[model samples]
Target: MRIERSNWEQRTLGEFFDLQMGKTPSRKDLSLWEDGDTPWVSISDMKESRYISDTKEHLPYQTIAECRIPIIPVGTVIMSFKLTIGKTCIVSKPLTTNEAIMAFYPKKGIEVNSSFLAYALSALKWKGNRAVKGVTINKKTISEKNFSLPPIGLQDNIAAELDAIQEVIDGYKDQIADLDALAQSIFLETFGDPISNPKGWKTELISKFGRIVTGNTPSRAISDYYNSQDIEWIKTDNIVKDLLTPTTAYEYLSFEGAKKGRIVKSGSILICCIAGSLQSIGRCCLTDRSLAFNQQINAIECDVNHIPLFVYCLIKASQQLLIDTASTGMKHILSKSDLSSICLPVPPLELQQQFANKIASIEQQKDLLRQQLADAEMLMAERMQYYFS
Candidate 1:
């Protein structure tokens, strides 16, 4: 059933809900923190597009009383109004968020589904008027925004439909995780412990199969070099778990910048050598064309005779092995020596091809499911706009 926009009533967010910001308890008062019974939510707890049932930290009962932080009731719509603007979630339980977060509590007689509100907030492209620098501690912006509200029954219906769609997406995500685990298990089963390949395949150093090319970051001093339409530059931040293609990245450099950094050709496998995200290791993407990478990334130009997909799978399967061999420090470092020693079951080209073909079919299925989920989410957003415009 389609609901006409004229049937819905409009209201400002501040009028329909009570917006409250949280406060941090004193760190020096350890006793206050220990005895607190309230769930303390940080920005990390609010996953942008996921349902949040529990927080990482909890505050003492006394801390809640002393701090005067309002206990945001269950069904409240919470959002990150600071560092990560526009990301929103609905609390499944009574929770107290950090200073960085702002909670929207629906006022009495002003009914709105928590899920619907969250979706609406998520769809909104919020561009705040003020420049939010990190100079002020606990700084946040919770402006009174407006949204269209349907009848209470209609709101519940919309939420239920979205919840069902979200469940399907969640199932796909769980399946992907399971598939990843299965792949790792299969790799380990085929190859014994770290040093030995159980299949007894002949071992070859990494340098034997490919040339290692270390990346360099073009000087950031020249601001004119960065352009949105420039050559795609891959960065460590662009690497996501199980992501074969990088859809988004920061700061693209000009063709001149690519030349200065020694442009990496298409099909070159990119590996991050940075510290902040040490666990984010293998990001082997077959770039469409030559592009620039930062100094922290190492690109491997594999021989054409060898399949790039096969190499990527091998690296992905051996991620744990590389992590195990990584040097212990604040940052895990995978040295060239460590990478060189990693071995794979060198099956015949025909067998590798067959395996790749099977994996490709599975990946295609995964992609279709992903696209379906995206479409559902888009439909939900459009419905929200119609009801709340």
Candidate 2:
């Protein structure tokens, strides 16, 4: 695809840089790892970051030297080519990575800007991701991807412009995180940590605070059960974090289908009881409208003494705890009985309402910040399209 034509030349990625994949020592070679200070990077360390400064595993310098593992210098661009394909980041510190990741550096005498190159790769990722397994990109395909190039000065200018927009977006993200942290701080201060119960508050099972309800799927053999706008049918994928908007409940069920599944009203708490992803097993969301869901999920109707918002926060905070109890294999699952048995600090209803009020106010601020970040991202995308589509 031709991104730009005016005052810019098209250069293949391989022409501008050399692609070298990382390496790993043998599993039996205990002497290679745990023996040094060199950072051994992998996909886990990639983490949606633009720049990677540390790694999950580190190799001893002796291992890199003995195994002839080439370490890349700071500022080198890195991309994962297998398992998690298309993840890319730049390094601020020297590190060594595994074979699933490839490091690209400007060719000798080439002055390609690092930030511009990183953003350029981001654009390529959308197009480069394919269905193939194992090796996602071969030398031929990597060499075939072209990037638009202006002179070094122009590249620097574009990179700076993009970086500024990204900085603003990052600032908003940090603010949002701070707001969330504030709520957690309040919870800890008021009710104490649920694990320790330092506040000496009463502790009780989740079931004591709410009634648990699991959903069921309408028979697929009946065509009339689906694709009707009259009802909202939720699934494990429909809930993310604490938000449960209508867009996520894309599958609509007819009135008949609603009969087969558990239809819940607004303010009900939804949790993923079954999912392939263990990380998603315990995620919960509060519904704002009546909804029906399949058997993969369960709903909670908290007692009058408990606030749904407070229950949502407490449940969200205990995600890892829930995941631990989920039976693992092909699909992770937490039976309704197991979910009800999970414990929490049962602070008084008045105190819980105070926390809910604070959360509602904080959410309003976060919503505004999110909208601003969205606008900045749109403008950034437009500028990127102009410079390097």
Q: CA shift at 254, candidate 2, in angstroms?
A: 2.0
TM-score of each: 0.74, 0.90
lDDT of 2 by residue, 256-346 (tens): 8889338888888889999988999888888888889889988898889999988888887778889988899999999999998888788
lDDT of each: 0.68, 0.82
Worst 10 residues of 1 by lDDT: 134-143
Q: How high a TM-score does candidate 2 get?
A: 0.90
Deviation in angstroms for 101 in model 2?
Answer: 1.9
Put down candidate 1 lDDT per residue, 156-197, tens digits, no spaces: 887787778777767767776666666556545644433456
Candidate 2, superposed: residue stretches over 4 Å from native: 1-4, 125-135, 242-247
Which portions of model 1 miss their true places by more than 4 Å?
Answer: 1-7, 28-38, 48-50, 60-70, 124-143, 192-205, 217-232, 248-257, 260-267, 281-292, 304-307, 320-358
Best by TM-score: 2
The CA lDDT at 285 in model 2 is: 86
Error of 2 at 51 (Å): 1.1
